[model samples]
Target: MKLLEVKLLTDNLSLAEKFYGKQLGFTRCHLSADELQIEMGSSVLIFRQTKEIKKPVYHFALNIPNNRLNEAIDWISAIASPLKLNSQGEIIADFRNWNAKSIYFIDPIGNIVEFIARFNLPNQSTEPFSVKSILTISEIGLVVNVVKNTVLEFADRFALDIFVPSTSTEQFAALGNDEGLFIVSEKNRHWYPTMINAQPFPLEIKFETDNNVVYNLSI
Candidate 1:
């Protein structure tokens, strides 16, 4: 599957624009007075301004070249401090079972953002890692009250298969494949390597599968 676009909520559109467009230097444009769109290689991320009293925070991941993990760390570290994943002050999370390495950071609105390199993928680049090296938006965390039910519902709705090496549990589950995944977890479960509790918020996602089926879903 491939994640084509995602629309998320943000309380402050101007700050998001500055952080993603100016600070990180990604290609971005103002969609409207309350909307900002950012291009991440093959995927597009849209932030819709919201006036809800409670601010919405999300967790999402971008795919990077398999060989550019270190270079990606260096590139993003220049703009924001990478969040440590271990007691050893290590920033990289090595998922040996998944054959992937990931680094995490927070956007200005406290959204947990990840850049992951899956070695099993064919995304190896000779160019230096930069914003252009981002392959696509690969994962989106969807917080729900019940992980099992949400996972089953999404599987039936999208005709998705469980990701290999990711076992479903009461707390967490992952659907789809390495190219794109929906991470379903029970509310209040801390995101991996972080203390932030998961929360439900409004968002939209558009994706396509290997068989050329497209789905536009809102949650």
Candidate 2:
């Protein structure tokens, strides 16, 4: 599945507008008094107003060029502080189990955002890494009540593959391929290397498949 757009909540709209538009240098799409859209290379990320946000945070990821993970890290560090591991104060992580490396950082509104480089996937860059090196918004947080069922529903409908199959609900489940995924978990989990806990929030995702099938869904 290819993630095309994600619409979720942000407590501070002005902060996000500045973070994504000015600081991170994302291309702004159409904007209104109440809604905003920013282009992230092959996909778009949207932040919409909610009536109220109880937790006001989420975990999401963008795909980065596998060959330029280090350069991508340096480029983002100049703008915002990367979230570091407590023991080592390290900003980058190597998930050998997934054949991936990731750099984590909090956004202006405290969302645990990540730029993950899945080496097993095709490295689609031949130039210097920048914010433009982001290939797509490849994952979104889905704080749910049942990890297995949620993943099965989407996988069955979209014919998507699982990135990691959770052995139980106590663990997080990621469903989809290297292209995109829905990170689902029922546990009140803190984003890795950070104390910020993810909350259940309304999110809408629209994506297409390799067979040219499209799915526009809300949850």
Top candidate, metric TM-score: 1
Q: Residues 132-212, candidate 2, lDDT per residue (tens digit)?
A: 788899888888777777777877888766675323345577777678887886756776777666668788889887787
Please give each candidate's TM-score: 0.97, 0.91
What is the Cα-based TM-score of model 1? 0.97
In every candidate, how many clashes are there?
Answer: 0, 0
Off by over 4 Å in 2: 164-169
Candidate 1 CA-lDDT value: 0.90
**Candidate 2 to truth, TM:** 0.91
Residue-level lDDT of model 1, residues 149-186, one tens digit each, is: 88778778777877888788899988988999998879
Superpose all Cα atoms of candidate 2 onto the true structure and report the RMSD in Å to 1 decimal.
2.0
Candidate 2 — what's its lDDT? 0.80
Report the Cα RMSD per candidate: 1.1, 2.0
